[model samples]
Target: MSDLVDKAKNFVAEKIANIKKPEATVTDVDFKNLSRDSVTFNAKVSVSNPYSTSIPICEISYTLKSATRMIASGTIPDPGSLPGNVTTVLDVPVKTPYTILVSLARDIGADWDIDYELDLGFTFDLPIIGDITLPLSTKGEIKLPTISDFF
Candidate 1:
């Protein structure tokens, strides 16, 4: 009886390990718009689903940081669903207030850009696997618009 139980455990473990899962990647981040109080940026995420049925996205949460300081963070509820057996791209919007940007003037002043790290979480429900969270992170510098660009 003990041998049979051990064999069953090994089989189940192997099956779980061999199962294929969906993959996601952050493609790009771009400036979207500038308002009186805040500047908005959009991060593009591409997810490839291998299943035959579409997976519903519970939420897309994001946090944008600069120099170890959190500049912006928010959650997009009920964003949408990922198409089955296809790569789907979604946009996550992040807004930073002018006051927060001003505090990072030292970094921006040096290179006319801001170094940032973006963390994103994608929550989805699989067929029988229950809930799964795909976390992605990227770091880069964003060039701030010059005075001439505003003109």
Candidate 2:
């Protein structure tokens, strides 16, 4: 009986390790030139699951923090499943020196972290059974040219 329990625990851990977390990034940051009342910036986040089993429904958290304060935070309901990938867009006011943090719980013991780049781009690879890091880099943040003059 004890051996069976240990085996079960190991199995569960292996599965949990296989679950992949979504990669959150700012795909596009468009600064609209208007009255400057409140400029809306659009950002995109992508999530992918590579496990054979379907991921359970859970809440996804996205947070944008600056050096001194948190710029924005939001949550979205995700019924994530295996071999599943999704992209979500968010609109936020303009703020400088911001970092985005995206996280989600895969299961009771499994969770995910968003990989980011210095240029405001990122990619996430799902965990698999044998290979810890999957070769797939399905999601990527596209860069847009910076506009010097916005009149």
Candidate 3:
């Protein structure tokens, strides 16, 4: 009897391990808007859902770093849902104050751009599998806003 129960547990574990999970990629990160006090950037995330229904996004947590300094970190709660069987592109807004940008002046002065590392956590509510968090990261340089952008 004990052996049968152990076998059943192993089978269940194998099935769960073989489940097809969603996949995601960070396509781009670009400047969006500039305010008097802060600048906003949009991180474009493309998620491919394998299931046949929409899955709710529990949260999107992110950290933006530049020159070894953390410029911004926060969580976006209940952003929305990922439609099943389709790849959806989501825009995540990351805002940084002028004060923080000033801290990265040395790096910016070198090339007129900011070298950044963005780490993103996409949490989704998956049926039977409970909640799962998919992590994605990207490193790139973003050009600073030019004088023409203000006009």
TM-score of each: 0.91, 0.39, 0.96
Query: Which predicted model would earn the best lDDT?
Result: 3
Candidate 1 has what TM-score?
A: 0.91
lDDT values for all models: 0.90, 0.37, 0.93
Model 3, poorest ten-residue lDDT window? 142-151
- Judging by TM-score against the true structure, name the best candidate: 3
Between prediction 1 and prediction 3, the one with superior TM-score is 3
**Order of candidate numbers by lDDT, starting with the best:** 3, 1, 2
lDDT of 3 by residue, 1-151 (tens): 9999999999999999999988999999999998899999999989999999999999999999987789999999999898879999999999999999988888888888999999999999998889999999999999987889879
lDDT of 2 by residue, 1-151 (tens): 9999999999999878565554444444443333334323344434344334444434434444323234454544542433454444433333322222212112211222222221232222233433222121122222222445433
| Order of models, best TM-score first | 3, 1, 2
Candidate 2's displacement at residue 64, Å, is 3.2
lDDT of predicted model 1: 0.90
Candidate 1 runs further than 4 Å off:
none
**Model 3 CA deviation exceeding 4 Å by range:** none
